[model samples]
Target: MEQSGGPRGPEGNEEARAAAHCYRHPDREANITCTRCERPICPECMISASVGFQCPECVKGGSGTGHAADANQPRTLAGGSLAADPRLVTKVLLGLNVAVFVAVMIQGDRLLDELLLFGQAATEPYGPVEGVAEGQWYRLLTSMFLHQEIWHILMNMLGLWFLGPPLEAALGRARFTGLYLLSGLAGSALTYLVAAPQQASLGASGAIFGLFGATAVLMRRMRYDMRPILVLLAINLLFTFTWSNISWEAHVGGLVAGAALAYALVHAPREKRTLVQYGAFGAMLLVVVVLCVVRTAQLTG
Candidate 1:
């Protein structure tokens, strides 16, 4: 008599096993099973554990002990928790810049006008007024990711790819992100304060220059050779002064902010490292805000 509901044949069993789906993502196939829970997990759901890969739930629950889940997690040099993907923040920032560049390319000058850093100006002559002085403060932050020219985005993204990952790895994601944004804000504030009120500026060059300064500080902190970065920075500064269309204010402002912030982040006393680092960030942000406030007064007065 034929077996009723018996075990599957070898090939059938293999096929059934191969068809297993991730518990978290039903649509996705999963081959690796979580060591802790024995749940099938896709790559995205896999978390490296002491013995083998674990699912997010298992990892979050720890090793069935009373200890904190991340108690044994590694820490970065700057006392931040080491991330599974050290360059994740860098990748996201680069992607944002590229995405903005693509959007600008498709939408043309209208999008650029809305995003660019400007003190006070209209999109066109006699058009509805815009710019930071007119309460369009978002421009200061948005302009950091905006780019018009292909070459401009290319250069900035290249700098980010090279410099960002190392900084992110060293300082950890949150601090690195803070450094980039505050530096960019510092640049925008300087440009608003000094440049012609109606003058327009947009680029990641400010943030890139900020990365340069941070890299120098990080290298020095690690006792690495200073000559290479110094030479590179010198060349960039020369170009900043000599290049006709370049905004020297943005470059200078970003460089100073990044250097100062990196110094505090890497050199803060270990006893109060977190407080000092965050305080430095707050101070930098305050400086940027103060500059914008003064400039706004001048423009609106």
Candidate 2:
């Protein structure tokens, strides 16, 4: 077909020149075609390709994948970061946990009494007097990010380092972060239910366990090996059961919550995946809140 601004063929033989125009700009002349799709593209619409220039569509699809991705735009994901920087969520979460741990170390033993998950229902409150009477519920979320010991934070962060990137890349930053936090909250909720109200508990282990459960479930859906994760979980569970100090309730709660959320996220319908996943997670959070409310009622009653 004759392209815009294309000259006549030599010797008046118009059939000798096969002209192609840019798909987007039908009026613009295009000589070079995309290597992947073989679509004609004008220089203005071309992007630098390893071999040759590619059309905008080919680049958006990812350099390797044939399918197209969304146009270049920053999207909000978990932890309120732009979509391109999914790793940022993981880094920030890890950084916060480390910073809190450092603060705990510097502040000495008193910090745990103030920061640990201590229910208002406890017979004798361990957290701050203002927190207990004022219904400072932030402990559930804050406790998930706080750790007292070097080895404890190190182990949990190590688990996050191994498990975080893949999940972040797959689920996007926001969803992954939501999973981590909700699982942590669930852990605190369960700990509140079973542990003594005055009992002091703190650490990211609950959140870490949640990540473990999510990774294991997602891997199973992908037909990936689950043995390693299962063994790890089992060993950890054994430690929780055998150890005098370990909060088994929190571990169990986080594992169950993470696995449930992972299941919802993985099986969510492709048509409304994000909506369904978040809605389902919101329902799960509601359940946690209900549990907290009921547990608190029992304590107060």
Candidate 3:
């Protein structure tokens, strides 16, 4: 006869312990099993459910019965998939900015001239012209990664380090990357639209401001305390208007674009989330292109 709740033999205990480990991460011990699949899952692999926690696969597949096979998969708060390393995109962006800064330091002003945002200008006194107006539109993007002053790069990189990880995790790599690039382009387009044709500007401030805007939106959406980000944004905006060297146009443009994009990404209906999120991205890109084109026409025609 067998006794219930009695001590087991060594082989039996070892098998029991092995069964307690998470199916997805064998090394992790799990006290809870997925409500849908009944498989052991660690906290990281658990997705909160109506009754209890479910595993990623169950959430991706549909309901506890797993009936809707073709339904959209589960995603992050902003319709993005969770990543193994959430900070990968942030690290890459930081690395690119740093690498461009180092290259500028080594190559001197020549590289800076090629990379910085300028609407229209002659390369040399009385020489042939070159700039965004002359079809050097790449400057809008390259300029976001270019910085000359040590203080400029330091400030921007510090902002990136602080604001980047959370947004990357929330938005995932692809959407976060799209937001950054589009925000930067929006900034460049605005600057080109309003600033003097011959004015030169270069820095990551535009993209950084965009991150600031998106962060505020994300915090509000998650119902997190918004005071801290709001205070920081206020301080930055104050500096933007007060500091003579700062490009206020870029800051403002990025902030608006980021806030709009983030809102669309996080608040879209679950049934149509992907379409709305990506559609917003395409719309933002279209706006940027239109701005650039109108500015180019103003300068060239």
Model 3, CA-based lDDT: 0.80
TM-score for all models, in order of appearance: 0.77, 0.72, 0.79
Write one digit per residue (lDDT tens) for candidate 2, span 78-155: 111235554777899999999988888889767765677877533245633433323767888888888877888898
Q: Tell me the spans in candidate 3 whose CA falls farther than 4 Å from its real position.
A: 1-74
Scored against the true structure, residue 47 in model 1 reaches a CA lDDT of 53
Error of 1 at 23 (Å): 38
Model 2 spans with C-alpha error above 4 angstroms? 1-86, 121-134
Which one is best on TM-score?
3
Clashes of each: 0, 3, 0
- Residue pairs with colliding backbones in model 2 are 77-174, 78-173, 78-174
Error of 3 at 52 (Å): 12
Candidate 3 local lDDT, 19-41, one digit each (tens): 67666676645566666656666
- Stretches of candidate 1 exceeding 4 Å from the true structure: 1-71
Whole-model lDDT values for every prediction: 0.80, 0.70, 0.80
User: What lDDT does candidate 3 reach at residue 101?
Assistant: 92
